[model samples]
Target chain A: MHEGSITSQIVENVLREAEKRKAKRVLEVHLEIGKLMFLNPEQVHFWYQMLTKNTILEGSQLLIEEKPGTVKCPKCGYEGDFQYVDDPALHMPMPTLNCPKCDGTVKIVSGKDCFIKTVKMLI
Target chain B: MKINDVVKAEEGEIFDIELDENILKANAELAQQNRELLRKQGVKAIDVMGSIGAGKTSLIEKMVQKLKTHYRIAVFKGDLTTTIDAEIIGKHGVNVVAINTGKECHLDANLVQKALRRLDLEATDLLFIENVGNLICPAEFPLGSEKRIVVISVTEGPYMVVKHPFIFMDADVAVINKIDLAEAMGVDIAKLQNDVKKINPKTKTVTTNCRTGKGVDQVIAALNL
Candidate 1:
């Protein structure tokens, strides 16, 4: 799964930061995961624990903050949260890429980020 | 190693370091470099993504048949294991590089960077990267192409466009392949095309029956090749 790959990246980043500061232990990792991304937080947490085992990040807390998906429509000059189309066939609610006001092709302004905001460690 | 030290360590000297870094930045930077390299070499590249049995290989073969005499074509076939698709495309006497992802579901920018090193980009005019037959994972990883094409056949059912909106959102050209079976399968081609347009209006939609080379020229035109 892509979640496994991304979580490994998180673990790698945390380990690198820990070693750079010569930190004795890592306490927490703060992540800003966007809702637009296909990543599942539970899957990310599962992979994080598995990847961080026997490392300085073992037993650390992963604090995730999910950001909303937002878009900007160039045609209608509409900027706001994207709408979702719900169906029984969909695995989850699918966010529409069209502008809410004009149904124009909207450019993604936010909610695609998977960032490491801050690392809390014992130096 | 004691419980007391563990408890004390949790409460002592917790420093929050500010490093607001995107995890996907590395891949994005590599993709940019790839775009530059291809542009400098005068090579046009397309990243083709779709589900398994979406006629991706057949469409490439048809393209090679039509454009082989006009330009030098090279292909990078991404599959989890076998180089079967590469073998099929290689029969056309073009440069075919098979990139086996092994256990990976999709080819990342790093993998493409390595593949680029092995190819003679200067000698190539058109490069087609057939991504591992997957709709979801490949959307997240861009392989640095001039265009991103997502192929979906009518047999995949009506909800493919709605169920996987991100891929359609990211696609530059959306090809609805195997239109020959639309009547038998009871699928409405126009509705599928409309769905793609609703998701990303900028995306050019093309319908093709790659078996008999029907609508293949339209695909070539859509790619601007």
Candidate 2:
């Protein structure tokens, strides 16, 4: 359901951009989803197909790229990627945020963003 | 000239447009607005998040019981499709707003902003937003609260802390509720607290039994309310 709302925002942005450029058709939409966002790309794509109907993005292709979760430790000065546990049966994976070097608490530096990076259109 | 030899070419251009905008930017901006508005109104807001049966409602009820006399309190209850929690809190004779998110798993900032608009902020000193019961989705969404609290009970199992560290990372305070049943469940109470401290050392950890009101005072002191 979160993906549905997010897809709506993406659609709105794409349509507004297309309208500004007077594009004949939207070809592709490039998105970057952070690992920590817990968003399922397949779900977003499924919702995009349904939400874009009759809009300028009706036939546009959606391409989603996942950004890995990165964290930096303030106490140990350790910076690295966090490990995510993926169970075959679970819908979402659990991310581990412990610092790899000192096992201290780390602050997330990346993998929280859900953004539209670019849009390809035929004008 | 032959008709076949007079063919013309069709021309088309492909253009790429960059839009480096976050899908959740709108929600974040609205959340900032809510935070600023709450600050201006002299209201302290807390976002309480946890899984189902984690004593979120019970802890809130206890907090309201303890703090209601000193400060005017208001609550915004968020659920997928029920007003049951709100009804329970409403019986305490305080302001309660029930927000049904339908199929959404978590409450967003926009929803909280609407609830804030409905409540008379001037009349309230403290506001508690009880987020939908789910550990995963709620951690990612900030509802513009001054402090974020994550409640987890021993009944849910011992692995909850390690399994859901992201929620602990986002929380300012972590409440391990239902400690009275820890011995019967064959689970340790201290190890769980240690797990939380390992993930977020800065997060204030409090053990509570909301039903009996044990350690609830520590929770208040930790929140500095």
Candidate 3:
């Protein structure tokens, strides 16, 4: 899964920053994940714990902030929240690409980021 | 304090570092480097992605057979464990490299960078990178290809396009393969294409029965190959 790899990258970045600052230990990691990313926060936490074993980030609290999905329709000039396609077969509702107003193709505006916002550590 | 001591301090001078780093940026940078490298060598590379059994290899085979006479082509096929697809493409008298991703569900730019080292880029005019047969993970990773083609067959049912909209949104060309089985499978190609268009009108949709080489030329034309 891409989330596994991405979480590993987050660990690498956090550790790099920690090392640069000469921190004795990491206290917390703050991540702002967008809705469209479809990344499971639990899976990320699991991977983070697995990758940070015996490291400065060990036992650090991970604060995940989920952002909502948003889109901008080009045809009808509609901007804001979009709709999700509900299906009985799917375990979760999928975000629809069609504009909620005009049902035309919409461009993703926000809520696609999986970013590491801040890292709290002891200097 | 001991250097290796486990200090779970409830109160301390907590320093906050605002990194504001995107997790996918590293791979995106590497992909840009790959794009520059391919451009310098005058090579056209296309990344092929789709669900398993979407006939990615077959489409590549047909394209290779038709264009081999005019261009020096190469293929980099990504799979979890086997080189079966690589072997299939190698029989077409073109240089083919198989990339084993181990447990990865998609091919990232870093892996493609390693594969590029094994290929003779200067001698190659066209490169086709067959990503792991996956619809979801591959959409998040870019392998520095000039174009991305996502193939979906009629056998996957009519909802495959809308069910996974992100991949189609990112794709430059959408190949609705297995048209020969459309009638028998009771799948509507028109609706599938419409779904693709509604997601991203910029994406060019082509229907093909890659097994019989039907509509393969249109795919080539769509990619400007």
- lDDT scores for all predictions? 0.89, 0.88, 0.89
**RMSD each, Å:** 3.1, 3.7, 4.6
Query: After superposing candidate 1, which stretches have Cα over 4 Å from the reference?
Result: A86-92, B1-12
Residue range with the least summed lDDT across 10 consecutive positions in model 3 chain A: A87-96
- Top DockQ prediction, candidate number: 1
User: Can you write out model 1's per-residue Cα lDDT over B46-140, one digit (the tens) per residue?
Assistant: 99999899999999999999999999999999999998889999999999989999999989888898999999998999999999999898888
A11-80 per-residue lDDT for model 3 (tens digits): 9999999889888899899999988786999898899899999999999999999998788887988888
For every candidate, how close is chain A to the native chain A in TM-score?
Answer: 0.91, 0.87, 0.89
What are the runs in model 2 whose C-alpha is more than 4 Å off? A49-60, A72-105, B1-11
User: What digit string (tens of lDDT, one per residue) describes model 2 on residues B87-118?
Assistant: 99999989999999988899999999999989
DockQ-wise, the better of 1 and 2 is 1
Candidate 1 matches the true fold with a TM-score of 0.92
**Candidate 2 per-residue C-alpha lDDT over A5-121 given as tens digits, one digit per residue, 9 for 90 to 100:** 778888988898999999888989999999878789999989999998987688889999999878998889988787554655435665665677885777899888898999998
Clashes of 3: 0
A52 Cα displacement, candidate 1 (Å) = 2.6
* DockQ of each candidate relative to the true complex: 0.72, 0.55, 0.56
- The global Cα lDDT (0 to 1) of model 1 is 0.89
